[model samples]
Target: MDGTFDREHHLIAAAHHLAKALESTTDLNHDTKWLLSDLSAHLSRAIELGKAHRAHNSSTAEIEARLMSAAQTITRLHSNHPKIWDAGHTTISEYLKAVAEVQRLTLSLEDMDLPKTSRELLDRAQNTLHSAMARLEDELAHALIRSKQGFLEHTEYEDSLVSNEDDSVRTGRFSSSESDVGYETDLVHPDSIPHIKSIAGLMFGSGYGREFCWVFTGFWRNVLAEHVAATLGFEQLSIEDVLRMEWELMNSRIRKWRAAVRGIIGTHLVAMKRLFDLVLGKYGDPITSSACLVEASRAPVMRLLNFGLAVSIGPHRPEWLFCLLDMYETLTGLQPEIDALFPDETGPSIRADFHDLLMRLGDSAMAIYRELENHISLCSSTTPLASGGVHPITKYVMNYVTFFVDYGETLERLFRAQDAGPGPNIPDHLRSLTSALEANLNWKSNLYNDRPLKHVFMMNNIHYMVRKVRESPVEQQFGDEWVKAHIGKFRHHATCYERETWGPVLDLLRDDRRVGKSGQKGMCRAFAAAFEGVYKRQTRWWVPDLQLREELKIKATKMVIHAYRDFLGRAGSSVCEKHVKYSEHELGTYILDLLEGSPKSI
Candidate 1:
């Protein structure tokens, strides 16, 4: 038997040497070269098969010895330097090669009906593979932990990624470009990925794929949790926590939650999916990679989504509406990415939860929007603003609706879906809201005892509403026609103001033929009393808008000044200088001072 083996080995060695010689030869015809090349290839292949067959037929004792040696090498290498699989370590290749050989021998033994000695050798090989996989799992965890990129500090994240606007405007501007969101750095060190993949492949091939997934997914779950908490300042909150938490604190956390969602979905999870593909795609199949990615990312992402869900289901306070809208807009914007990243069995559930959350938020936002109109309609004031300036509810509602301008397109889509009436639109909603506010203002204006001051109050508020719409993007939603219509409303209020306040004073100056020459002085006295009274009272009234204040002043002057000049000319011949109080120019000057917001007593 020994002699036969020796002759076979010698024959294979001679064939390999001759094949090498023939491969290097060049001086031959085309047919001769082709025949020689084919013979050389066949001879090389036969030599490889002979060597493999000889190894396979070798003694079980020799195979056992080889397995023991490899096992010892793996154990010694791992024991000596536990982190040999770390990114920069050079010894990891040697360790991995030994484990790979153990896996090969163990897999080869599985197909054979081994004798007692060969079975023992197979058991040793399997044990070595198991130990190697266990060590590799530790190495994978360590490599992931050591190579993870540091999270951005909260302040730095806010400065770089979050907007500085107030919550309402911040939410309104939820649309983000790909470049605007996400981390620029890799999640794990690029150099470490190959080692991770190598470890993963070996473990997967050795039937430790489930264990490998556990290590990978568990480590990443913690990493993402840390990033969400440490960097983005988001924490998992139960529905009760959301409901019971103070709105001030809750609002702050909601903002942080938004930042967390953007960072995780847009940057960290994207990097994580790529890393999963890099590490596990080749060895564990696409399904396994996708499953691991979903497992790792689901908890962290759900932590964010759950908060939004809580807010969506919570009380529909008017103050919370914008944040809700912001959350809704953010999720709506990220739906495509969410769907793409999680495409496994859990993906449908996640997508369903995500869609359900969006629907709830939209429903909540619509409820709050409707609540705003109701609040405005029901709003009442027992005491009027003595200055006849803008009402508190007017400022609140207009400023509230003005923030919606930034969310105009988003709100338009939402309103269209939520509005059940035929042809329901954003402009109509805005117009309805403004009408509620107007009705509220009209009711509140009755609190004023002076009728003309009521007109002043209406004029001031209507002008303010128009100015707010004109100054914001809401003008587009409301359209120029709506703005023009409101402009006409305020101007009509202005006309009524002039008629009520100044018209009586001007009527007092009309030439009366019924007045005898002796009675002209008494008429002059009455004019002085009426003019001074109008000046003292109306000067004390306020118009906060500069443009409207000046316009009212100009028109008042034109009406009163011309009327007084004519009255003085007709009554000057009979009246004494004492009754003629002052010149027409002084009256015009004083009229200009009316509606300056500051009260001046004459």
Candidate 2:
């Protein structure tokens, strides 16, 4: 096993070895450091011996001394270095080239081709040179491997420092540290012991496997980044050497840290994002001072959500249906006291502020789910992995179903007495939200939709809190009033496509039996969405291309036309006319303009 790579398969083998090492061991920092240092020392000796042998090419006596030194270095390492197997290796194939150059020169100065004294000198030099060259080549190859080992160790140190920060979360039950000097002590369970490992291990496992994953990814990323730099003309390590080093590390280290760290960061990112969502809901817009109240306590649910996302969407992006699994788990742990709107359960409940934000986010996410699902279906129509749109829809909708249906509305009813009965600090926005919920106990993203059922069903998750919120008393649904107001605004925005403009389109969706559906309610309601997208940039007749052409220009216009034509062909003229019927075009449009451009104006 001369240390040189076989060129064809060595790098891959090395990576596997390194990866295995990383996976199998608990920690290499303490025990492995000495091996690295010793490896470095032996490599240095080999290089020095190679150099000395090359320098003594004119005399066998001198060549013998240099060869002996290399032999000792080899013995000190307890074995011949892999250089024997990798016999002709060097930096840039220098050993091969040197051998060829010397052989050619030696041939030119053969004994028969020169004078007696000169011939004798040439013979001795040629013999010594060949032997010295062989020994030097062997040592050079050995030294190269030792150098690589040195590099691998250096990378491990760097990786230990920058490997992703794992904010360890203690989720399982806590246990006492005492061994019971008294009658009783809380015995730590074997299963929980893993959870209570040192903070570092809990966050980013100290085991060999975890460290290996981080180090492997870091080293490979550096190598690739270096390759990118090389492509741009900067000089650095060869992709081959770096790649080889990566393989070696992978083989030795399996990176247990990856699973745990991934678990931790994913939890934090999810909670941070959800907190951001809740703030958007209650505050609408939080200024620096007031927003400080929305603190993340790193709750159990938050950790679970993060772990689910990491395992499902972010880190490994698995094929199994994880969103549903998470949804099921969240539902199984349901409690009675959670007020969906105010959502501050006294014990282990989703925080009030965060719950509020999650509801709004759930509402917003429905819109995104529709859009992204439609996009995926349109783009990947024929592919097998395309399950087409299912992937994108599952991403947000499945993960957040409980937030919208049970959590959001539950809080509203429970807190209604508290909100309306006594608080002078209540904002107008909060009050309006509750009022809207009272009016539409079944209010949702697509309750009015009649087509594709999925659109209505896509966000139709009114199971727990959402149903409760909608069904609650007017005062209980202060937040609903805010929602209704936005819907009103969206509804009015549809005027841009009214009978005068996009009228025929709305008619088809609402009343038309085309697409083979019976009701036009869904289509009639979609006007707000259609007009909002098309007229958002500019509503002027000269600005919106649809304003100029009788035919549509953008995606929104096309959808409207499709809904209208499909409706007109089967459902008839009255279908198109109803697009103008809901709350009057002027009223709806006014509501929309107010919601978007200036709520203060209202």
Candidate 3:
């Protein structure tokens, strides 16, 4: 009361007293609460007095003194709930309500003559409120931690109802007030605290909301930074395990971030980007840049590839490779959306993370291919062909090479800019390995006694390899040139088969002495012998593709028919009436049925 007569004197004493009180009181008390309530009411009265006295042309010092009293009073009130403030029990709405009240007091004096006091009081009130809000921000940050802790496991964390996709599934941490209303009628646990979302909503309302957005984004950046550091710091995990775990974690964060932003309106994009920069920008180190707390993500993606592509050539050849390819594609496909969320102009490009991820994936795939090619080159071809009629190595190679076919467009887009060309030297290595395989097939065919039969084996396998590569995305790597080259080789093999097996029969048909000499029937017996030997032998062999089989059959038939018909017309009935068992026409007809050899003949 003694200091109250001089307004300036009162405000100075109030500030000093309140500051001291706040420093001294570490515990909650009824006395402190009453003192705060009284001070708040007094400030309200002082604001009213100042506004009423303002239009009377009071001195600047006198008016300033009154407003300063109110300002100091509000600042004192901020320290009132020390225990609750320290414990983070102060709700954001409650804090904002107090700020709004103080703001209203400051605004009431807007038309007054006390320019200095009005500005000073308003600044002081706003600053005090900001300090209180800062404390509230700490609470909100803790609430996020609490929400995470409420879930016993990461799976439960995923199941939390705070998802941007589905807001109706109310988890206790984010449920609406309406959903929680029934808690009052039921046996009460602790009074339900405001949900994290409700608190966030209050903090984000209208005036000064932008500042809180910065704070909010900064908080999440720190949170995510810690998450990344923890994920990467798996000291006990194998490098492979560390990589896999980090991949899963990073993927989870990206997905959650994506889902979370779905509910965010376009207006909030700037704030969202700030958060993105904290998590993904190169310079967003948390401790140094808390206001813009961004940390660049260092994903253990290469190790993920190493584990995924560790497949050998024997049995599990491409399955592991396929699984990784799937992951690569999935991550690749999600890039645009995730990138849109966290774009940074001055920092590293938004697309850099995804681009790096894809490049690493390509490198991993190339590494796998190199290992597989080495394995293919060293492994013997003596292993029986797999059940699919392709040799084990051939099947493995085909599968490995074609695994990325579905991702052709993506790869082209990714590597399209490569001035040095697609390296890891994958395409050329694969082509050379394929040629080696062909040579190996030729060498292996020597194991068979019959020349024609050996060529058939070569034809079947080469045809299989060519067909697989032709139909798949492997063509992207191997190219049209490789395809045409292989197809030509297949044609050459078919021609060789005709020459080795059917050449003798056609030659005999054209022999003039064979007409009746030594009772050797002209070309009829020659046709029978050749058909019985070659066609019957082919009948036992398996051709996997029906389309290819038909083509081979047509080619083989055409070669024999023209020559046989010409010979038959030349030799005629003169040869037929002698030692020839069948007429010339009958001989012509028999060669037609060559591919369908009998089981006895076979």
Choose the strongest candidate by lDDT: 1
What tens-digit string does per-residue lDDT give for candidate 3 at 1-602? 32354575457457646745664665858787667657656665665565555444354445446545644654555567543333344433455455455455444555455456357655664565566556556665555444432101121122222222221322212223212211211101123233444444444432444454465555554543444334334222343542344333533433333222221211122333443333323332333222232222222222222322321111223223433344344455455544554445422433464456556655554445446655666666564332214465566556555544444454454454444365334577568778777777776777677776666667777887788787766777898888888788777776787788778767776766444544346356666666667555655555566676667666666766777667556665666566455444554454444433233342
306-412: candidate 1 lDDT, tens digit per residue: 88888888888777777788888778877877887887564777778888898899889878876788877887768888889788777777877677656666777
TM-score versus the correct structure, for each prediction: 0.75, 0.18, 0.42
The superposed Cα distance between candidate 3 and the true structure at residue 176, in angstroms, equals: 34
Q: Report the error of model 2 at residue 228, Å.
A: 17
- TM-score leaderboard ranking: 1, 3, 2
Candidate 2 residues 95-161, lDDT tens each? 3333344444454455233435456545554664445444443343333233321111101101211
How large an RMSD does model 3 have?
18.0
Model 3 segments more than 4 A misplaced:
1-319, 328-366, 383-392, 402-422, 425-427, 464-484, 507-518, 521-530, 542-548, 558-602
Off by over 4 Å in 1: 1-58, 86-89, 106-128, 150-171, 175-185, 231-234, 244-255, 283-286, 318-322, 369-375, 396-423, 472-485, 504-540, 558-593, 599-602
On lDDT, the stronger of 2 and 3 is 3
lDDT (0-100) at residue 483 of candidate 3?
Answer: 85
Model with the higher lDDT, candidate 1 or 3: 1
Task: Specify the poorest-scoring 10-residue window by lDDT in model 1.
Answer: 155-164
